[model samples]
Target: MSFLDGKSLEPRDEAYRTHEITKKGLPLSAIWKGDANSISQLTVFRHFDSASVSEGFIGEGPNTVWVIDYPTLERIYYDLVVNFDVFGSVSHQILTRMYMDYLRMESEALFLSFLPVADREPILKHWYRGALAQAKVFYGHSHLLIDTPAAIHYGGKDPKNELIRMIGTRSMRSTHSARPTTNYVPSDLKVLDNLSAKKSLWLRYLPELSYVVVHDDHGEITNVISMVVNRAHANVSFIFGEEDRRIPEEDTLMLVNGLLGSYPNFIFWIDQSEIGKFADAAKQVSDTKSMDQWVARYGVRRTDPRIWSVLDRLHYYKQHYYKQKDGESEGLLDVSRYENL
Candidate 1:
């Protein structure tokens, strides 16, 4: 007889013998109730711990009256207990974006990459799925939540400011919206020599991106853009490398100065501690604009109404090292701390 067919037989009947509940000499009445007939025919197995129970089949409880197949139930239960956060995050991304679009509002986009060792492949894949889910959420809201692989025009058509083509993927070819505009090689002589005259080194290995993202690793990605930027020899370089990579603080000053002419109206964010260095660099480049004056006229500080109407609202403020007021000493705060005007 089929096991399920046998299950239909009455548990109290002679054909289906019931096992007595016992613990030493005591009856398991608390769980089974006082009447012997009330005891369930289903075996009462004890799990070693919550983990074992958690790994059990998914779907509604025994009494809920549902019909989920075994394989599906098992998959659901395993995901619920072992990777709940990832599943929930992905679901939330989709649902929340839908809600935002229903309200006809744009949602802010965020991109995140998770890095984990090789041994934790399952967990890492879940993170990648979670990121895709987040992207979908933003897309649902009628907002574009694009991944880094997205290619489009970042600069105008003017030859002086056209989009730089990092010499890597032709993926942008598929994305007709952002065609190859400019070579955009950096002006710095040193970076050019280092990169072997490659104007667009970032495109060299699009295949690697697939695996990196699939594996949910970001170490390679973190360096790609910076590597591309360095090749162009731009005055202001955003270099990335292994953890031991040195950020060239001194040369950064030169690049910031060069940006003054190229991107004068642009606002920026830097660590509060680094603000002084950037300011000093600006001074060395041009004495006409002091930090306070620049903050008052062109920076985000200007638009702030609480303290001094010092900053604009477009650029979001973030934390940085800082000096304390009242001769307190050096510390850190967001630009808002100074702008709370």
Candidate 2:
């Protein structure tokens, strides 16, 4: 029989028969007290550690009824036995719940990659349905729950100042409604090269521009913009490989400084293993403040809130699915932790 068909039968019939509970010596008197002739059949069952009898009664003599609510009983027993929380001790319940939530968010983010970008909004809206309600529980004001975009325009004569002002203004804005009017042109590469060349400490760890973010028609990397100002941690993270594949510390620091010049409050994160490389590079360069002021390192602990937030953001941007080469870890928290749970 199908599992659904088995489930449809009364629990007592199939469960009792399968277990041969009559051998356990459960008295039929516990099931019903009725007319002797009315007694049709008797069955006994063991559920968890408790035993009970199910008796078929047709007519009443000295009618007394006994009922065992197995489902509710089992739930109560399991909760008491498995979920008992001790006083003055930390409970894994909260951490486990948060980890599960992170996994759910990651899964939702991955699913978005399968959809066309144009169709993503409606799906995202549906998925974030109760977010406002949940936010309301924590924040007293309704205005705080709503997202409002800010606008800033940069119009100046100096090219360097204009570029800095434009990025800083955009970084300050709460939402990005339009793509940047300025593209990362070939001339912009000269600008970055010139800026790095002037700085004695700039390690030229430039990866291909494509590796940073996929550009749209306007040549703007929207995902990078979104992730740099992500609400959860307001941190940007980079994962590097060992030896040859490792991103240059100079390039990472330079990028961090450029972003920090615009958003002073932003944090930058790197893999825990790469911290020594950055430190060693920092010793050679005079710009040690960038590393000290904004940088943090993280390991593989899935329970770390910052790591969880970073993974969620990266997954949302479709940046977490890249294949790793030999001797390189993806720096992603193991999703199997939640899967196993």
Candidate 3:
């Protein structure tokens, strides 16, 4: 028996509307509507988990078939890679290679497959925090002291951004003291002592120099330390620097656990390295053959419905609420829309 023989893959109720809206911009939908025909053949297959398949099936069975030209299918693949932020550049390349390999193995056009969305916020957050912590551990020899004016001007009200900007700013006027040696000492080893010292310094000089950025050298800037003062409480949140290198999963997990034990409140951002590491680890742990296989097998199951809902709302915003430019519009999508996703 086929894997999808008894299963209904059709969308239900609101999901049907969501499906239709998402398909509007898809290449497969365009091909089905006869908008373009540049391919020799296109084939759609339903992905199924082998574990869920009945014993009689050869492997996981495919269902919900669609046939189009090869050129059309290739166009769809390119469209997905270009339009979707769902996969990073490396991941996109991997997917493209996987598609080609699968096509070669099966001797048919590989067209459409279902992918579930996953909630990556927590994992991303953890990874980001770990990067910051790791930066401090690996590169904490140089320190950059930023004056209050630069911190205020660049960061505005956000303490985190203010701290990051203070370190990131290229202007020399904002930099009170560049690469202060004494401050480069590892503070994590003496966090309590450093906190007390920081508090005292804040009490005396909080109004003058409110932020600081610490680094090892001026080369690649793999790590940087930032600090913001809380004037009212006469306290400081010592923000560790971020690293660009891909930290191992075990290292990140250990670092996070260690940091949590040391500092109750630690701030970090999920850098590309951590994100890539997490994705690789997830692929390894998954029962599927590859990252592409995992996506095919569980993409829809991991997909967050809120993405579709937000897209629908954004469409509404663009149509009814957004201001028009000469009866036309510019790109309606913003980076903020994918912040939580």
Candidate 4:
């Protein structure tokens, strides 16, 4: 509750102090209607508690969630906040970036704990597509991780996505959140998801995050969604040649309900009537010229007569409607990166 906006906690006893704290002061439901069902299944863990669930940590990948612990948590705080210097020399910057790679791998390893033992290495290998000998070996040899088998069992061939599904069902069973965690609502997102699976360049032209305002056939606003493009990386190990590490054909996409991310690279307005065509057009995007034409069709450009009006309505819906319904804060979204397209 301390983490969620409009949610809070107070000691029952006014005189209570940190030294006097002995157990959890609130139940899991007080925090989440049902939180961490997958984690609570871990009966082998001796020190697991509701406090750990309250931490509310998550990993980088689609299905990867987390419960951060003290040492690594401290290291994370120090690694980026204390040890890093924005004004440092090029070598210093390179070293900082290099250190972050191993930290990311550790976080990824925590996600690996939930997968079936046999599937773990294979999935990780895909994540590290072009990783060199040392980078590949580093994950298996890490002292920071333990081989904790998942308490949950799987029955399907696709356990990775199955686990992801279970997590969503359990966590969202009681919340009033009007959002989709993964996959996507419209068929468009599924198209992007499927194309990525087949190693298509479907997501290559999209920015890191794009805001989409969907309207009904009657021209009434229906929903606002964000398209998140996750560019596939062969390896983050090497300090240079970022272009070489990129896997454009395998780039993937995620669509989340409501506003997401700090910088929205593009803002798009689409009537529900043309939404299907939009996805089809995205799948067929072959080059920059094609993308420009597509943008001209759906995008709200800087020169659009109603540009500010469109932005205002997006903000109005986010602050007045979504914020009240979801209990999630709706802060100002950044548009400094808005695409001229």
Residue lDDT tens for model 1, 38-157: 211121111111111111122111211111223324544544454355546665645433433322211111111111122123322332332445434433432112211222223333
Which of the numbered candidates is closest to the native, going by highest lDDT? 4
Question: lDDT per prediction?
Answer: 0.23, 0.29, 0.26, 0.58
Give model 4's TM-score versus the native structure: 0.66
Q: For each candidate, give its TM-score against the true structure.
A: 0.19, 0.18, 0.14, 0.66
Model 3 error, position 201 (Å): 48
C-alpha-based local distance difference test score of model 1: 0.23
CA shift at 13, candidate 3, in angstroms?
68
Error of 4 at 70 (Å): 3.4
Model 3 vs. true fold: TM: 0.14
The number of the candidate with the highest TM-score is: 4
Candidate 3 residue runs with Cα over 4 Å from true position: 1-169, 172-280, 283-288, 296-307, 313-331, 334-341
* Candidate 2 structure, TM-score to reference: 0.18
Q: Could you tell me the lDDT of residue 22 within candidate 2?
A: 27
Count of clashes, each model:
29, 0, 15, 0
Tens digit of lDDT per residue, candidate 4, span 1-341?
A: 11111111122112112323312221122222333332222211011011111111122234333323344467678877898888889988776666666556655655565566777777777666677465455554542223344445689998767765565556666443444343235765455543462455546677777887888775557787777666556765676787888767656565655565556778889998888888788777778898888889988888888688888777777787545655665677667777785
- lDDT tens readout by residue for model 3, 1-341: 22122121122212322555333222222222221222122222111100111111111112112233454346456645665455468766555544443223112111111111121122223323533443232112211111001112222433332322222232222333232212232334123122322223222211111111111232121222222221121111122121233222211110111100111111222232343443343325332245444333222111445345434433454444223312343234332212221
